[model samples]
Target: MKAGKLAALGAALLIGAAPAWAEAPSAAPGAARIADTATDEARLMALFRDDARREDALDPLALIYRGTAPDPAALRRLFTDSQLRAQRGSVIQSLALLRRIDRRRLGAERQISYDVFLAAKREEAEWLRPDSIALTAVRPFNHFGGLHIEFPSLMAKDGAVKYEDSADYRTNLALIRAFPTVLDNAVARFRQGLASGVVESRLTTANMIAQIDALLAQSPEQSPFYSPVREFSAGIAASEQPALRAAYGAAIRDEVLPAYRRLRAFLNDEYLPAAREQVGIAAMKGGPGLYRRYAGRQTTLPVEPEVIHQLGLAEVARIQTGMDQVKRELGYGGTLKSFFDVIRTDPRYHPKTREELARGFAEAARQVDALVPQYFSRLPKTRLAIEPYPAYREKFEAGGSYNQGAPDGSRPGVFFYNTFDLPSRFLTGITTLYLHEGAPGHHFQISLAQEDASLPDFQRFGGNNAYVEGWALYAETLGYPMGFYKDPLQHWGTLDDEMLRAMRLVVDTGLHAKGWSREQAIDYMLANSGMGKSDATAEVERYIAWPGQALSYKIGALTIQRLRKKAETALGPRFDIRAFHDQVLGSGALPLPILEAKIDRWIAARKAG
Candidate 1:
């Protein structure tokens, strides 16, 4: 039930540069075999280092444009068409590989090693924050360079990476320089309550401050961040890169720390205090216009907000009617609402342990895979595994999400479930979420695109909220009537999930655009759907923080449904679900307009044949 403007937060977290590296040959059998040899360890290290450098690389143009308004003419010259295309291309491959590794390592006994790898990453990031390398490369005045903050540390204990004391000083120095601008923008955005207020939930907002406070509270030497800087400095020393290392230290001490102090002071004094207690976008100024833009971006469609609002209202009506039909079919005379009530209170959906909850999802994955060939011809090269969310982050997640694999088969896709509160991991939504996050949803779409090496990297990896999420939401319905949910309870569960998305439209718009208070949104959810108080509250807060994003789920699902129906109507007897799926996924991900064009082309080709 995330309610924050996730789009803004999501974009903010992504920072780094790519170290230019010579291209490696394809992942042929020979190359893989060589990778496994003891001698190849050096090669692996070199590759990892190169990958590390690549992560921090920034577009020089983006750096230049920061703070200054974009000069369309000047900006045009700063980036070539090819460079932008290549950057997008690289994103696809990088994300694919990243997802691949997570999927493969999930649940293995040696999974601790993956933690070590991540720990190493934390350390490296710390080094890059304030070290000579970061200081020289990262423009202190710009947000694009230097380091980026992340959710939290996933690793709990000492691992392969030795912990050192002096890391935060170096990193904080680099990070703080940009803090003034970032915090100022956040504050300004919050102040401008137009198109939904930009305020976040006090709890989550507090968490943001806490994250910074934790760092600031630490001694420069004893900080979790400082360890990385010291090691990086030592590494450079051993390599006799004394000049580079010294230069990095001076930049961190001089330019970065002051900026951090400024942001910290602002959060404590201004932003956090003004944070709203309300969760949803409702009651905010001009919520409707904001939600409309959110809807447009989420769907990648130009559909008007009023039209979408009406569509959502209609869908809710339609779905409720269908639920009644289901009840009548089962000879249950009670109202459709009663059936929903019965299912919510039922114990059959409850799982006893974290493992069972996860296994339930894994089982669904298996079930979907078994049925894959029946409706879809193409499969992703990337494999997906179901895993519990990492402890640090799970507390905040209501639903599971897909962790895409690396494109080069260096990683596997992962579906991370929030197994913290078992009851909230409602059984009814399990199958739908699996399909949405795994199987023919995110897992299939993301990995398939990544696997397509010929596509531009950005096209594969680059995301449009509407296309990716829409495809997955659409996938939820593909197997719904195929007897996937044989049990009445399970069948109800499927509908419940569908209704949840449909409801998102009403509540999302209601809160963000209609001036419905947070309490109003929560009550609406509780009354219309079987959402628990906790889940409902979290969700409402998420919507407030992130205006219009909630609308994407149902909107995307509906678009895909319409498209599939188009295919069905056009092809009739020749229609193949699997073929249709393959075609849809084969193009990787594109904006809805591009997706429509591609699909139309496919339809034409099939008709011609």
Candidate 2:
């Protein structure tokens, strides 16, 4: 992995020049002039390799969000356009980054390094996953044909607007070119798993099929995707010449539909037959090991499964104790579970309309954003937009999500509230949710990281799942101190929200690792956390589908909390929350250990100062 190589190079550079950067603000008296010019070509080659690795990592996201088409003609045209841009960009970026390395200085390793670079480049060029997957599994998901509309107009109003620019199209084309090769390997893996009687959930396959059918059922002209195209074509008659419209229409009707139909056929004829009814990553090849790798990657620590399991157990216990205290304070409950029932049945918590519910969240987020500047001095320059979840994807999205803005300042960060089901958008724990998902959490951390140019691309753009989610969870805990839980009910609501994360630790580990059935996990959550049955069921299913990812929230939050306490104690009255936060966020999203090390360094520096 280029991970170790990158770290080694960074360390080597640091060791060679730490004195230069770390010297006092005033010049060191009589310091010998250091004009060291020893450059490591080996290190440069490693950086080249790491840059390729970075591209490989980002390719999947580009493919997933580009657009959807229902038929072969449209799909092929999209392939010709969107996917092609992504692939070409990946190869060009890889080659360009590789070229930046000084090859001649590598001595004997020069040819081998060049060969490795070429091999990696070829591999990227040869990847067919984006196209193949779209042609197979993904095609079924792209129900929107040429109706090409981007909706929720909430984004456009909030200044998070982005139009299809030539650059966007260029990037899309790059992915198309690389899509085929990636898909080939993926299909081979899928087939091998099928041969061994190991496959994905039957439910996942069914969902894909159902989504595809919905798309196909829509008239070609009525598709959400086509409307935008139509509007665009009509609006700029000169630009949307006859040839372009015909080509667009032809692509939608021909290439896209056939791709969807082919995928539908495979799901029905082959893949679905071998699919398992169960929903957990545990059943996959190297299941436990793979999860551990994910855990390590997400948390940026070498946390063992057993340790996490124990941590989950402890969190569940601690939160349940807090809930008991809250119950007594409220003075109207039988058991804690019954209080949860009361909250669920309570009318005051539920909003009457989707718009009302969405406005509630947006207002709460705005309130929090207002308070954030007091605590954080190093805030991101980028803007934030609040929007309702897109309608077509609401069924798949859990309550809310935060999609990062573009890196080049063209787009603002987005926080989407899924208000499809109004009753589901109750005030219960809403304030805490806002804090965790928006201000002082994801918005603060992710935005700051993206804005930091001093950090390497990987640190700024890449992330440790644990640190990001964990920090957010920690932010929720910070609400009370910030005077957010002024309402007693909101205070109880905050505790309830924390209890949910605690429950995730147990339920997620239960379903995937501990042989707990889906129903069992759902019941445990519903009874313990007082969540609605629908919410509880969906949460359990998400855990089953995505494994160890749920564990990162509590685990990551705990590490940050621990570090903060350590810093506070070390600096005493001199410790500034703003400075401490700047130190934490300015470095970007690093692994927990790296984060801790950075924090420790910051603390010691404060002490010395």
Number of the predicted model whose lDDT against the real structure is largest: 2
Per-model TM against the reference: 0.63, 0.75
Candidate 1: 10-residue stretch with minimal lDDT: 151-160
Off by over 4 Å in 2: 1-189, 222-224, 233-246, 328-331
Candidate 2 lDDT over residue span 121-176, tens digit each: 44344333343233223222211211111221211222223325433323333333
What are the RMSDs of all candidates, in order? 14.7, 10.2
- lDDT of candidate 1 vs native? 0.54
Per-residue lDDT over 515-556 for candidate 1, one digit per residue giving the tens place of the 0 to 100 score = 678789888777766655667776776666566777787765
